[model samples]
Target: VEVSGLPPNLNRSCCDCGVYALKYIESHMLNLPLDLINEDNIREARLKLAVDLWAASKDPVLIDRMEKYEPHNNSSDIVDVS
Candidate 1:
């Protein structure tokens, strides 16, 4: 499938970037002819890939900003219906 025109702010926030990462893997990487991920190696591979990406970006400020976000507190004023 041809995926295009992702949201402009897809990488603006940590959550959005995470979603984008998952989408990217699903759309592109998963189709590659490799069986590197399975029940036994998935966890290790996931952590390794995340660390590698973080190192490649070399943007600790963005990581700190993402860590500081508190969506739950931001929406605390709203009443929950369920």
Candidate 2:
């Protein structure tokens, strides 16, 4: 969504859209079989989604913003990617 590229204060719509999608997916998962919802499968799915999303964006500012997001827990992981 273009809202993802908006300033943080203006990004609520995009963030809520993502949250809604996740809630919908979770509801689907709950009704699905246990044999298909493994941790490895979820992780792989997340990675693939992230890669595909990154590939779809052409904005340098958004790219730079994404580089600043740290997946690990630590202050040193912080980066001024912008």
Candidate 3:
């Protein structure tokens, strides 16, 4: 639905678009109202995300994924930076 009457939207028209997108998916999945996440409560959402990630950090799968992400197989691979 192109709104010709309205001015064209420039790039990054919406601030924190990624945040909004993640919130949209979360709301849709949880059957929660999208309005639950807004500018005022965005910080709360981020804090919750941080808490969730921190809690999951102890999960073996997540730890393994992080381990694989480091690509350095041996201690010799790491340069000794004094």
Candidate 4:
């Protein structure tokens, strides 16, 4: 698939390919028609649908790194690594 609108810095490597594939599958699966999926065949249908949609859709952007500008904790206390 040829995914567009991806960040220019997005990572594309074999190490992260599976992660990208799963994300793509999840996104597509959410929009699947309810009538096309049922309890008895949901498993198979989900896999098939995901594959088909992924094949037809564009390539996904796989992020390998991101810059964090702020601290996650509100406490000012610091821990000594030593």
Candidate 5:
């Protein structure tokens, strides 16, 4: 079944397209409103997803790499991966 009224693919990049697809599916699954899903805040959504995934990851190598890339001075755990 096709989902209607999903946010338009404004960026047109493969990465952005994937993000839109997943978000649309997720909203549909959760019976959430689709209005919040838009191009304007997709970058922020993507960043949040990345941080969440990174935090949840248990791979030692990836964790080490993330630590190197993530800021060490910040007291907050969230990485500014943007």
Candidate 6:
């Protein structure tokens, strides 16, 4: 697996496609039972994705933002601040 290639010290690698796959998975996870996506679930999924992105970037700002993620009640797309 591609994840097995990176050294322990360099755990972050920009696998662009992998990132997209994560996005897709997040979307799927957020989809609702009535075929109407739940905004809260989507917001949670987005936060998780942002955390993953922050880990891959090794950027302090992103990392800090990851911890401060707030789930908004309005819309799922709005929570995707990453």
Better of 1 and 3 by lDDT: 3
Model 3: colliding residue pairs: none
Give the alpha carbon lDDT tens digit for every residue of 1-82 in model 2: 1112222342233434453345346646576433353333555555666787777697788889888988876577668889
**TM of each candidate vs. truth:** 0.29, 0.30, 0.51, 0.25, 0.55, 0.28
Global Cα RMSD, each model: 11.9, 16.5, 10.0, 16.0, 14.2, 18.4
Candidate 3 Cα outliers beyond 4 Å, as residue runs: 1-15, 64-82
lDDT of residue 4 for candidate 2: 21
> Per model, how many backbone clashes are there?
0, 0, 0, 4, 0, 0
- The lDDT-based order of candidates, best leading, equals 5, 3, 1, 2, 6, 4
Best by lDDT: 5
| lDDT per residue as tens, model 4, 1-82 | 6343534433333344444445556656686433332234445544775787776555343222223245576877887989
Q: Give the TM-score of candidate 1.
A: 0.29
Kindly list the per-residue Cα lDDT of model 1 for residues 1-82, writing each as its tens digit: 7654444533433434443455457646557422332345445555776797878677888778888977764554768799
C-alpha lDDT of candidate 4 relative to the true structure: 0.48
Off by over 4 Å in 6: 1-37, 59-82
TM-score-based ranking: 5, 3, 2, 1, 6, 4
* Each model's lDDT: 0.55, 0.52, 0.67, 0.48, 0.77, 0.51
Model 1 alpha-carbon drift over 4 Å, by segment: 1-36, 59-82
What is candidate 5's lDDT per residue for 1-81, written digit by digit as tens?
A: 854854444656557877776787888899888877877788888998888787779788887887889555857677887
State in Å the error of residue 41, model 3.
Answer: 0.8
Off by over 4 Å in 4: 1-4, 12-14, 31-82
Per-residue error for 73 in candidate 2, Å, reads: 37
Candidate 4 weakest lDDT stretch, 10 residues: 59-68
Best by TM-score: 5
* Candidate 2, position 13, lDDT: 34
